[model samples]
Target chain A: MNIPMPDFMPALPEMFLLGMTCVILLLDLFLTERSRVVTYLLAQSTLLGALLLTIMLYDNSRTLTFSDTFVLDPMGSVLKGAIYIATFFVFLYSKGYLRARNMFKGEFYILGLFGVLGMNVLVSAHSLITVYLGLELLSLSMYAMVALQRDSVVASEAAMKYFVLGAMASAMLLYGMSMLYGMTGSLDLTHINQVTAAVGSGQQVVLAFALVFIIVGVAFKLGAVPFHMWLPDVYHGAPTAVTLYLSTAPKLAAFAMMMRLLVDGLGGLHAEWQGILVLLAVASLALGNLVAIAQSNIKRMLAYSAISHIGFLLLGVLSGTAAGYAASMFYAITYVVMTLGGFGMVVLMSRAGFEADRIEDFKGLNERSPWFAFMMLILMFSMTGVPPLLGFWAKLAVIEALLGAGGLTWLAVVAVIFSVVGAFYYLRVVKTMYFDKADAGAAAIESTLELRVMLSANGLAVLALGIYPGTLMALCATALSH
Target chain B: MSFEQILFYVFSAITVLAAGMVITVRNPVHAAMFLVLTFFSSAALWMLLEAEFLAIVLVLVYVGAVMVLFLFVVMMLDLNTTLLREGFARYLPLGILVAVLIAVIMGLAVGQNHFGLAQVAAPAPHAASYSNTQQLGELLYTTYVYPFEIAAVILLVAIVAAIALTLRRRPNTKHQRVDQQVATRREDRVRLVSMTAEERK
Candidate 1:
């Protein structure tokens, strides 16, 4: 067979970031401790440059490149933009935390930039091979980031656990992809969709098996129940700065992976996969919310909360409609914002020698700094899906999607109940901030003006978006339409 | 049975036996040797199927390079064989049950339905001059070039991750600082004066 040359235009942003990351990696080696800020600046500029390129190459229509392995689409563009903005905030918040812990090094920024590049590729992947490569790249970076603090035994243990579990999940995904390839005789997702759609009963068994494996892999990444064993430990053990990075941007890439695999490639097998997703979603909601209530550590609590939020995300995907997909996209973006704010507070409250991981750290936060406490309140309230916050709209959109799906109304009710149960912990945080008295010797929050400003903007954005989520929702809908 | 069919059975038997020994062996070094044997037998099996490139790669990359690394690691690690084997008997029942279950499932899935020779005929033998490696390389660099590049990137990430995770800077270790060295001045280090000499007496 004659081979066709691959086009690289659609991958311009990825190419740009890849080149920049290498330069930054080498540039960071020569940087002194005081000059590490240069690395941070370069990393940020890399992200900005990528964002600009993505915008310049933006089109509402989908375009396939690199032999149809990579794709450029409106959904990817929107998600890439969201990931960049989230990473920008994460970097800004992490700088002080890193410096305080003597973990201020070029490695964090370089690895982080690499992770962002991975996310960008994941967002644009159109084939199984691309998806696996991007996911591995991201996983490796995350495992390194989690263990960046070499002196911390806990961090090392956490990194080992994350690495092992993540490798297994990647294997499961590859196994599933291999099975799908066997059944369809093609690795291209579109071709697989066509083959799956045309398969007879005999092939359906293999397809079902593949779907089970793929969903297991996806659930592991989402930290859904049963596969969520590693999430809380990694979250609690890593430095607060890494936890902040972990919680915010990676979810967007994971969401993109789900969309590409489930909605784009395996849409033909929806009837089968949706059943599996429904079970996972309900289990995640029940387990995530219930377990989170028992956690006294804020990081662990948010880890469980991330699990439950993933349930909500799956609820949107299981709706099996364009509108449902759009709603999930919207929820994913909003959840990232909420994550930045929630973990930003953890980073803010932490000092050089003190870790603000305990639930009690937020006691009388209002008494300390009313402005930030209110921001914290907004984040917690939004997470609990309280009214007039962006989190509310996010949940409402998913619930609306489920209701629109007709038969899934009962699942919606179960989700709402779990969210209500989930609300208790978040409100307890709010109560601690507002009602409890601050300890006389509690360390004061040492924060930069940039963090305070960005965090406030992040917090208020939730409230602002909640009150009026029209534009963003419309954008999500538009991205999903084509 | 034909001579070729008898040879096939021999290679298959060796591959299976060696693979079984890989997991069941007590000594880590023995396990590594068993794995190498398994890889060689599998390469022979692949050669029987006319997949010359894959057979050579299995021997060259896996048995030659990867197995050597495994053997080195096994030697370097101070592992207690008795301690490692302590819990094996206790877990044997559960392991056997799962293994049997998997065997039965495979029997039904691949054995009964998919593996019928009538369903999948053996390929005709290639001409003696046919170079599987050339065709494989052409496909890898041309048609599958996207995946090829991606695989390269994954390896790059692996290198970065391995180094970043394992490399540590010990705070107590003495290392020259270029900036400190460059900024050093004679006055800051020496501090000599006539009054100081009188005070010393």
Candidate 2:
């Protein structure tokens, strides 16, 4: 069969990023140490260009390319835009920290760009092959990024754990995909959807079995409970810069993976996966919140907080409605914004010899710089779901979505109760920053002006969005409406 | 039985028996040998399916290259097989129980058409002119080219990651710097020694 060439217009951003990444990879090798800043500039500019292309290509209609192996739709566009923005900020946040730590190498930026490309591919994935490839690309880059600080044993351990578990998860996910292919006789998600919709009753059990493995992959990627064992260790072990990137952009890829695999491809079997997600959401919410309270390290604390946030995100997903999907997208974006500022604070406070990972490191932070203290305050409050902040609206939207999905009132109540329980840790961070006396040996915030400016905007954006979330909310709803 | 049916049974029985021996063998070397047999028999089974390209690649890759490496490693290592087998007897019951459970489940599933297994029916035979390899190649190049390229990128990332994680410049190492070697004039590595030569004389 002779296949027609796919339209390059929809894949413009990805092709551009892929080509620019190659160019940047070569350019970095030729540049001197002092001129490394140019590489950073080029990387950021590449992301900006991709974002511009994605925005230009935004449309109401879905466009499939590469023999339906890739897709361009409103949801993909929105997610791409978010990933680009998050990754752009991530590069900025990491620059100072990476420079101070003597890891200001081009590889960080290159792997980061690769990771970004992976996210774009994942968001635009139209088939099982692309989904698996995109996820592996994202994961391999992250594993390398985790181990980028080659001399740190902790970083190496984290990287190893992540690599082994991530590789296994990918294998299991592939197994599930193979099973789906065997049953449906197709790899393209659209064709698979058609096949599944008309599948005989006898095959439903086998399909359900395959769905379990796929759900495991999704849960593991999302860092939901039980499968979330790697999240905290990886977060705590990695350099704050890598952690910031890990905590932000790649999440959109996971969310997109869930949306593609579950809603688009397996919508016919919603009843099978819904119960699984519900269990994952509840377990994540209960355990994540309760465990976070006993944590002293802020990175691990945020890790647990991320798990609970995944709970809310999954709640939005398991509702099995358009509104819930939109709500999940909103929650995912909100979680990214909060984490960018949260981990950004850690990066800002860290100096060459000091790692501001411990919660006690924030003692007397208010006295050190009241402005940043307020930024931290806003971030923590937003995360705790306090009113008039982004996290509150995100949680409310998800809870409303859960309630709207009939017969799920109890899950909503569980989410709210955990939110209340989760508030204590966020409050403790604030109280430590404000009430505690400045320790004589406290590390000073080693922030450059750009970081300080971006960090402030990052925090204020959360509050601003919290105050007026309608526009963003509408964007999410409209993205999924098609 | 028909000749084709006899070949299928023969290959499958050898495959399963060798796979079982691969785990049960006391010596690592024997285990490795059994693994090679398993691979060979599995290839035969693939051949029965008319997947000639896959079967040949499996034999060449796994049996030819990988199993050789495995044998080399097994021969080189000074392994304490007795120590390794110390816990095997203790765990045998639990292992057998779990294996039986899985076998039963698979047996039940395969008995029906749920798995599309050999027990239910055979796939339709292809004509002598049909070629699986050619069809697969055409589909890969034409339709699955995007994923194929992505897979290539994944390999590139793996190479980059390996270098990034493991490759380091040891400041004290005596490795030659090609740039310094080529850029060497007279003064960098030599010293004028006329007075020292007279003193030695």
The number of the candidate with the highest TM-score is 1
Candidate number with greatest DockQ: 2
Candidate 2: DockQ?
A: 0.61
Write one digit per residue (lDDT tens) for candidate 1, span A380-465: 99999988889999999999999999999999999999999999999999999999999999866788888888888898899999
Superposed model 2: Cα runs more than 4 Å off: A1-3, B16-36, B64-111, B117-121, B176-201
Model 2 lDDT tens row, B1-201: 999989999999999999999988888999999999999999999999899999999999999999999999999999998888798889999999998986675565444667655423668989999988998898788888899888988888888888888788789978878998999999988997675335544
Task: Report the C-alpha lDDT of model 2 over A192-262, residue by residue, as the tens digit.
Answer: 88889888788786787678779989889999988999999999999999999999998889999999999
- The lDDT, on a scale of 0 to 1, for candidate 2 is 0.92
**TM-score (C-alpha, index-matched) for candidate 2:** 0.92
Per-residue lDDT of model 1, residues B1-201, tens digit only: 988788899999999999999888888899999999999999998888888889999999999999999999999999898887888899999999999986676455554355356645667888999999998899788767767876777677778777877887679998999998999999879976665335544
**Residue A110 error, candidate 1, Å:** 1.7
Error of 2 at A85 (Å): 0.7
